[model samples]
Target: MTHPDTRRPSSLTAKLAGLACLLTLAPLQANDRLGPINITAAREAPAIAPAMPETVITREEIERSQARSITDLLAGRAGLTVSNEGGPGKLSSVSIWGQSANRTAVFLDGVRIGSVSAGQSYLEHIPLEQIERIEIVRGPRSGQWGADAGGGVIQIFTREGTEDGSHLSGGIGAGSRSQREADAHIGARQGAFDYSLGVAHRETDGFDACENGGPYTPPCYADEPDNDGYQRDSLQLQAGYRFGEGGHVRVHVLAASAEVEYDGPTNNSEIEQRTIGLSASTGRIGFWQLRTRAGRHIDDQDYFRDRHFDSRFDTQRDTLSLANDFFLGPSTTLTLGADQTDDKLSSTTDYVEDARRNRGLFAQINTRLGERLDVQAALRRDFNEQFGTANTGSLDLAYRLDDAWTLTAGHGTSFNVPSFNLLYYPPYCIVPGLCFATANPDLEPERTRTSRAGVTWTRGPWAIEATAFRSSADDLISSPPPSYVPENVSEATIRGAELAAGWTTDKWSARTSLTYLSTESEATGEPLPKQPRWSGRLTVDRQLGAFSLGTTLRGRSGSENDNQGYVVADLRGSYRVAPDWRIEARVDNVFDRDYEVVDGFYQAPRGVFVSLRYGR
Candidate 1:
């Protein structure tokens, strides 16, 4: 790979040197406590004590980090890997705990959001400006949901009205590569009604997305030296009304449209995604709490080799769910739920089957035994039109050693239905050059079982969490040798460990995480692609009067791409000039480390950005 200029500032040393002087500083007391809450770990309750290992990124963290997209916001978490083709507004994929990208399910406000044909969400297009918080469960919870959650679950919460009062906030930013961004948010709570609205726009004249430099070059690079650019616009709205004591009804709608330039026959592509959901919950009736929701989502894509046209694919899904929670006692609860989803796909290419439906029933029981032990058992059965039926279950146990320590363990089973393209791709051939690729119509669902154990310690201003997990899969899907046709042929095993620690005191706060993973196919004994052997991250921040400064460093071992490891650092600073006005600046890729997450594709070099904001 080549670049315009490799020369860059020593950002790594500068960031470290700047933080070295604040080692003994105090914490920012005005900021809320860093322990974020999780809403996706259980089905019966909206909020519960943490019995499973999870990670949460709050709005404050999102704002402080100055993330541009979902991919940037969740780059280096434990037991996870995010691979982008090049830079912003490009294709991106996320693999959790060594599972395939499709095995990880994504949701927005409890509604499943993704493509029926591809079986995954386009994370790069989700604007961060509308996000309130993100909840990531490190392990599977298939019994609570259904298919496509074989690896883990990620739930994104959009901005909601604040209890403090009505407020309006907006920001504008500019950065390297002719990058520009603008966003506005308005939220308020009045009487029994609450509402929030947000809009965002971002664009960038990005670097060359290819590594080969130009069309004449060999190996892997773009066919042209022209810079690939990207643009996106997003809108989000949420409103709710409360009645009775604890009865409430809510509705959420979000839409995003993006156009990105790339180096291929398809010189440019456009994507439009939209989601609308309605949910209602009743107050405690006797001993049961009832909730029901209905949602619809659409994923549409149009590709252009040039200004003319090339192809298009569109997917739509409708989901309905009803759940009830029965409180048996102060220490026991029973949860029952039913879910249904109908998916339809439309594409330029013909498919044998373009639509499918799924129905599921699930139950769970959670109990706290005495003062130390907590147990949860859940079971689910799903019936699909393509594949007959599947049963998945899970067991979770937790023991509190004392006020500062807790031990937990869990075992679960999960499965994924074959995607539309994997099972129904039609045969086609061009005149002079003949070509054919067959799909496996009889493909079976992939199944996995995972067991994990962990311990957590929290005391004073320090917290630590560690977990070890092992997963085995049957009927693994992959392209067979010469034919390169999809097949469920191999058995696989994956093992990993994740550790996270944090400390805060007065004016200083720091957090760090380390992850180790290994994966193998029992048939070939070769390591899985894109699963890094190790990764680590460190972040430290200091508060001084109305000014705050932070530094982040991340390192990861080479997986399938580059043969060596790489490290990147970033520095951020913000100052509040008035009660509702602030200015912030950030420098990313401080060291200008040249590396690649996708094989033969280079990453971004050093870049700087500045922004000004009003209100939050």
Candidate 2:
């Protein structure tokens, strides 16, 4: 491991030194009245179960925070870690509970969005303006989602036209380091048809460069002569049509393009992707539901180096699902479902043309043990053409202790198959004669067992929650020695605890969270890479008259690996200039912490942005 010189301005150091001053001098306003958090976006029917440890960020929160990207809104959440390879629009990755980025599944309206070829999800392309809400389910969800559910699931639901009225909203903003953004959205709903369209563009210059200078000679420096920065543009369209009363069809389309500049052997690279999906749901039979969906994705990547090499990756998937719910009695319910998926991938890089099919059947029983206790058990069996078969199950229990306290626990098993790149990519020499990459075609799927127990307390206008969780993974996939292909590592483990509390009053609100994690590779006896032991965040918002002010403090511990600890503060303010218009300003990285989320990557410096948002 090496230490890279993160070139930051002197003003950044001063800001860090004055953190205590800023916190004390800032006015402490009274709390603002806020409604309780709710998860209405989930497909499962709502129940008055025990209060669980969870957080919800609504559309209003997104607007007030003025997040530059989707990752910004997710960065400081409990038990989460983010790694970025370039600037704002560059490639970024996130992990939960020490699991790698690829182990976490991302979904848009229940449709998987990651690239099947690389097993990576691009968070920078999603336009926040089009998002309604984000539901983050922490812990294992293998029984419900199948593969890549070992870590957790991030479900993003786009906005839909409501009964209020047709609306249009847009904004433009400019920040430090040549960062700029433009976004717009339009939506309308008629008698039986609803439609929405959105577009966004972002560009940034990034930070200065640094070079690799260490015993490992790992390219650790950020300074590159040709480091130009990154740019991204995205467009999305969605429409839904409703028939008589029991059926509806929805269509979604998304396109994104990004260009990132790296400072190492690889030159600038451009990535472009397009996705189209069609889904239809019907409820004609008694207590029966049927859903069918088809999706296609095209990914193109161009590399700029000696001789130009271009690669194009394309994938198509079709799914059919049917479920029936049986109400045996007043206190018991049973659900049975069957699902099947057909996937195909094609590439121009001389790689293997792969096709896979999956079929699964699942059943769940929800029962009320008594007036104060509830339990749910679910089991699923899946058969894959490439990975053979896997079985997963989950159990959830909730107990209401009193009016203010509740307890809950859950356990589950999940499995993930190897991605195409992990099994088919060509090995290349790193240092002349030393080959650094290898591939294996007979890799076993990774498996995980997850368990969580938590307690929640709600009293008056304050709510607090704490949870402890432990997960053990078997046959963990990793590249051991010189192999680029994944091998089944013996085992790995992650244990962590999270604490969150929020207080709301009449005109002000405050929330804070603390998370501690310990992750290790049982085989190598080394701490996991890029995972920090401690992270914390504090946020405060105040409203006076027609203006509001907010501040956030986020910090992370130094890595056990070769990374350093860094803390950043952010400030934001908004004014209601008119009934339908608002002006907002945000200052990010106020201390300009010279830190890197990834070991060998560049992070943006302190920046400022201001924008005006209007809607009708």
Candidate 3:
């Protein structure tokens, strides 16, 4: 049986059509008793399927990987690139399809979380242990998700309650560079009510993030050699109750507070990220099923140097969403949704504008042309208080050629509004002698047009997927050179190809993936900065009774502005002592390769860690 993203169909013909198209998929049930009805986390069926090229990382996989950070797990995955200024908890960014992080949208438990001033989500502060699942949708998505979706979307679902019982789980660990961590989760479900709560704390004394540099040279532009340290405390809660046979209501909250030390004029930062939302879903309203949510997200950050506060930025986003799904015909379903976001910003520096509102209305259709062909289409209209009206659309098609082969193609359009800092932050220098960045009020919104095609083959124990894609970006934004002023720089084209394969069995499992990316500035005919051309990863695992072992190797080629390429490997093992107890250990950067993910910074040399976990 297949468990889809959206609500199940009410008609037998629609159900049959859905079953035919999903025979090759694995099951991911949102709600067992309610039948695939998820109000808060469901984007669409195609976004989670091969139609749009998605990847799902589950809790089980998270535990097996033994990854210290979310970026470590996400990097080297298909169509993704990650950069870090130094070790963990410093400055980090993830790009999709060679685009900037601001072009990608992120959602945590259905709450869109990000910094309005920086125009990107602070994914570093989120506790990795609290995440239950992640859905990565690649390519442009503004036709379905509205602004700030020029690249794609990533949805993170925090741990939820176990059905019909009470459970407790926790773990503690210590690692290299004096790293330490502890986390606990307690959950229960009784009658119609269910809730899960988690809390985590992590701290580390990191290596020197940057080498001492001359005043006129790079590598942080300062002489600081002390060990940098980082700390974070986080909490998450999810609660829900079923009212009627098909009516459910839920609430979720996530909060994190962190302090990060780096090498710069403003060398330390205090950050806070919090989000809360309430959602309700009803099984039937006449011929339709309905879901609605209201939420508030906050990103607050403060910069400090030597215990003195330097600057502050506080932002708030208020959001409301409504979606209705109905059957249009025997093999077709239509989904219509409305969204509204109000963003307000407060900062130490002055801005020309403090707040803006965005409103969007969209409609999507999923239909089967025949027994072997399926199609999805979407159209959206958005109106912004500052940027005015915009329209976007997308189309995706999938055809089943035989029992083991499938062909897919898609086209999408997306747009991103200029950020508050991009539009109006005044020019200033934190270190007196040098200015970092400036803003332009005349900046225009960025737009992207993307096209992709792919093929998939699957059998009993083997699966493979390959795709080629191209994206044309208009009015791209950049901050270059001496002034570092933000502007609509130039139009660009990004082209790439990706392939992934996996094989599984009872005793052994192996998986591998590779990506080739190319980006060019139409004006200068040169490659963009900081984008790697080739990246790939290989993973091998083995099982022997209660003990398991695995190894992962990741490598990426050099690029326009990147240093010489590097290869890194991780070794991990775990032993199940009892039915509910386990011990795990990992050695990161086993080769101790000294390389920089970004210019003027250093990555971790080598590290070892061990953890003890107890759970149900």
The C-alpha RMSD of each candidate to the native structure, in angstroms, is 5.6, 5.4, 9.1
> How many clashing pairs in candidate 3?
0
Off by more than 4 A, model 1? 1-37, 44-50, 213-222, 426-438, 480-483, 561-564
lDDT tens string, model 1, 1-616?
Answer: 2110000011010112122222221111112222433568776364353467677777888887777778766766777787777788777877789887788998988889987877777688888999998877867789888888878998888999976579999999999999999999999999999999999999999988766445443223236666888999999999999998578999999999999887654568888999999999997788888999999999988877676687788899999999988889988878899999999999887888889999999998888889898888889999997788999998888899998888999999999988887788754232224434656788889999999998877778787777899999999876544465777857989999887777777788787766778888788786666677776667788999899999877666776423545677889999999999999999999988886666655678899999999888
Candidate 3 worst ten-residue window by lDDT: 1-10
lDDT (Cα, 0-100) at 490 in candidate 3 = 75
Candidate 2 lDDT by residue in tens digits, 1-616: 1111011111101112322321211111112111342232122322222233345567777887788778888775777787655566556667877787778877776566676666657677677877877766677766766677778777777777765458898888887878888889888989889988889888877664434443224443223444457788888888998885357898988788887665544446677777777777664445455656566655666655333653456655555566565556566657677777676667664556477788888877767787778776778899988888999988877787887777889888998888776677555333356444445677788999989998766677677767889989998877643232467889998888887677767687777766777887899986666677776667888998789999988766655443565677899998989988888899988887776665555566778998888873
The reply for model 2, stretches above 4 Å from the true place, is 1-53, 209-217, 220-223, 242-247, 284-286, 310-319, 327-333, 429-434, 480-485
Off by over 4 Å in 3: 1-50, 243-246
TM match of model 2 to true structure: 0.87
The lDDT of each candidate is: 0.78, 0.67, 0.77
Candidate 1, clashing residue pairs? 26-506, 26-507, 26-508, 27-505, 27-506, 27-507, 27-508, 212-221, 215-223
Model 3 gets an lDDT of 0.77
Per-model TM-score, in order, reads 0.92, 0.87, 0.91
